[model samples]
Target: MSIAESVVRTIEDKGAGAFVESYDPAEENMVINLGPVHPSTHGVLRLVLELSGETVLDCRPVIGYLHTGIEKECEDQTWRGAVTAVTRMDYLAPFHNEQAFSLAVEKLLDLEVPPRGKYIRTLMSELGRLSSHLVWFGTSGLDMGAMSAMFYGFRERELFLDFYEMVTGLRMNHGYNIPGGVWQDLPEGWEEVCANIVSIMPGRIDDYESLLTENPIWLERTKGVGIMSIEDAVRFGATGPIGRAAGLDWDLRRDMPYEAYGELSFEVPVASEGDVYARYQVRMAEMRESIKLVGQVMEKMPEGDYKNMDPKIMPPPRSELNRSMEAVIHHFKLVTQGYTVPAGDAYAAVESPRGELGAYVVSDGGTAPYRCHVRDPSFINLQSLASMAKGGLVADLIAVIASVDPVMGGVDR
Candidate 1:
């Protein structure tokens, strides 16, 4: 859409919500509300901006519009049920949510998932990483005036989502990852589908770089705009692409290997400039690395059972229930009350597409979790927005927000 057309559409969509309350137009400088539903802020985020003409003097991110109180809701559910709750926290990276929650519960139980399970988890997580970055790339491009990238991204994303649906029977919030392992084994021809995605993505990513990396307009909009210093990134607890863009060369997949990341060989991409362009480059490089991980995972996917053998944690098969009354009772209990986790607290962190998505869970030797809290990267990484937007033009704040890539579901959780 043309800039003028985009403006008219935005005004129409926002309608009465665009109006500022109890304000004066006579004031020298104006405080404007960007949106509780603005397109640029990304995902129902509101930015109250004190603007000097087109320059932004201050930016206060207004959040909680998407809040669902998921953390508190997690406490109300069983150990396994917490996975279902958290999977909705970051709807974009649902697998990461399930992975982190499962890992935490597993840690508390002192359970080690089988090698095949570990490899599958790693494989799915990397695919999620690629899926999320594609979204960021698309929306970031749209925010920065590159509309075509959005089309390319969603096109590729559908194929990736198809792979997810084949495994879990759902697309968005698949609670496929469980505490013991995955929900089930891979479906037939899963490897071929995975390999096809791996084959197509690399070349398409190259296409993205060719379109935007050196394009004068793209560089002009992104380079030196919304720069984050190494100090601020660390102080703000920013991880993943945002942290890597700021010269913080730390990836939990490499630095603190969980699942099968340690067994894989891949490079952690980094950039020193810490600007929108730097973040863009970091994410792009990471996509290539994810492709490498995908290849390794597809080829070396271990052979064995997916979930753990323990009947207490994983419910008995339906076939077994027909023959044995004990199996029938176990399945009923597992479905209704869920499994008991030992009395202890554990925290697990995974390198999500955005950043470090950590889950902290406390068990009271019961079916339900005593408490559960997610250290969502979106919630923390969002703090850097005001700092990044403070002296820049109002137009650039959108690019900054896109680079931070804060998923509002996670943020409001």
Candidate 2:
């Protein structure tokens, strides 16, 4: 008889009770809820984990605990006003959300924002990217027990936001980018504040590397934990740093250019490790590239009308209303009824800090959107958590979630 047959015969003779008794029930599996309320989650994300002792057998991420119906809310607002709602989707990469939505509206309207507007959008997107990474870095460090990283990361973010406030008049969710272009031109002294931030960030990044990249505890916790194979990452639809870490080697900024990304030269960093450490390294490198792009945008930024000068789409300047009766009527109509887009649908995507942030907008020749749907990267990237966490120690699961860097606002929205 074959060895398999002999073993089967023995098991048949011994019976089901004997087989059941062969292994400890405690070692079989234990189901536990990790959170809808945990810090490492970065927002209200609950993960159901099946544990075989401390080893994760399987994980199911439970999302929507923080849902605010942002997509649905977008349809209620005017085309230009939708930015206020969509900007809240990612929470961290608000500019990217606005950019994608604005680009989609522009596509539906068949309008191009002026060169200076395009460059400004690009600059803000990069700055938002840096801000997003800093948050990720801070939280990842906190999750891993490197307390200093949080402080350092937020320090950079505060200075970054100071520049944001200078231009848009709000640090977060500025509602700055609109359908035709931004809400206004870059304010006076924006260059000086931006220039100082760009100058000091390079040395700070070096300091961050020294603290965590080579630290024994950080290396031990993150180096090989939560390994996702390149094939699995692709199958799971993982993108951005998570995808790049698995050797995807594709950045929408480089592969699929948007905004002024085509004009700005930068490197797309990729790693084959597909581990928590690889994700960390990928984000760190991306921050450097964003800093470089910010510098380029500032240097080459053109001077022109920030918003498209089309009176049908953009309201005439407040100053123009004082002089011209036609301008008065234009501003009143735009503020009240809003501009109607041509009846059509369009999808525009930008490389958000997390991954591919896409907006699909439907216009029915109305002041408001017929339908607006956001393909948030947080939602897409969350699918990989189970794959990354399975077969890893339970403790490292925190590191895995942090490495993915999901913003619950985006996922649940």
Candidate 2 segments exceeding 4 Å error: 1-27
TM-score for predicted model 1 compared with the true structure: 0.93
Model 2 RMSD vs true structure: 7.2
Candidate 1 per-residue lDDT over residues 1-413, each given as its tens digit? 42223333454567536544323357545567787777887888877777768887777776788999888888888888788888999999999999999999999988889999999999999999999999999999998899999999999999989999999999989999999999889999998899899899999999999999999999999999998999999888889899999999999999999999888899999999999999999999999999999999888888998889788888887789889998888899999998888899899999999999999899889889899999999999988887889889988998899999999999998
lDDT of 2 at 48: 64
- Stretch of 10 with least lDDT, candidate 2: 15-24
TM-score of each: 0.93, 0.93
lDDT of 2 at 52: 76
